[model samples]
Target: MQQSEALCPKFEFAFSILSRKWTGLIIQTLLPGPKRFREIADMIPNMSDRMLSERLKELEGEGIVMRTVYPDIPVRIEYALTEKGKSLESVMREVQKWAQQWVDC
Candidate 1:
């Protein structure tokens, strides 16, 4: 086995995705339900629209987020967690609980 993969393959893979900026938060936001692109963007302070779009696309590529478009005059689009994405809820909540207990902020 490769040295890095042997050490902690699962963790390495999970962290590679979760550690990206705004990724965890995006997952958290989607836990409630699907939301529009703008709604997700608004949840995070100081996050640029461009960045949000980029992150959403990245998550979609990973099969963690699904994008749906409605046929409307304005072309409304929304983002939601797929079954794969919803799988991370427990992990995220565990992290939140850990942060609550240990994080200074």
Candidate 2:
């Protein structure tokens, strides 16, 4: 590791979180608006219900995602981004732009 990377632990920390599997995708999915658990799952192809649930919990714990529960027959739940999470929108957009330029699909 470079000396600068070692010195700037915050960058490393942020990169670690964003680099995790599905973290970026989850954030991207929530960028539009709040959504039900199933809605998120359906948006991301090949995402398991279990993995989605786990990532949501982790994001919630980090204050990046907000989970709301409504009282109903079976129970209704929705997940949305908090202010902190919304702050990442620009970053996500930049990534998307970069991917478009450099990655061939």
Query: Residue 12 CA error for candidate 1 (Å)?
Result: 0.9
Error of 2 at 35 (Å): 0.4
Number of backbone collisions per candidate: 0, 0
- Pairs that collide in candidate 1 are none
Q: List candidate 2 stretches off by more than 4 Å.
A: 1-7
Candidate 1, residue 74: Cα displacement in angstroms equals 1.9
TM per candidate comes to: 0.90, 0.91
The runs of at least 3 residues in candidate 1 whose Cα sits more than 4 Å from the true structure, single-residue gaps closed, are 1-5
Pairs with backbone N, CA or C atoms under 3 Å apart (clashes), candidate 2: none
* lDDT tens per residue, model 2, 12-88: 88998899899999999999999999899998988899999999999999999999999997999989999999999
lDDT of each: 0.94, 0.93
- Model 2 scores worst on lDDT over the 10 consecutive residues at 1-10
Q: What is the model-wide C-alpha lDDT for candidate 2?
A: 0.93
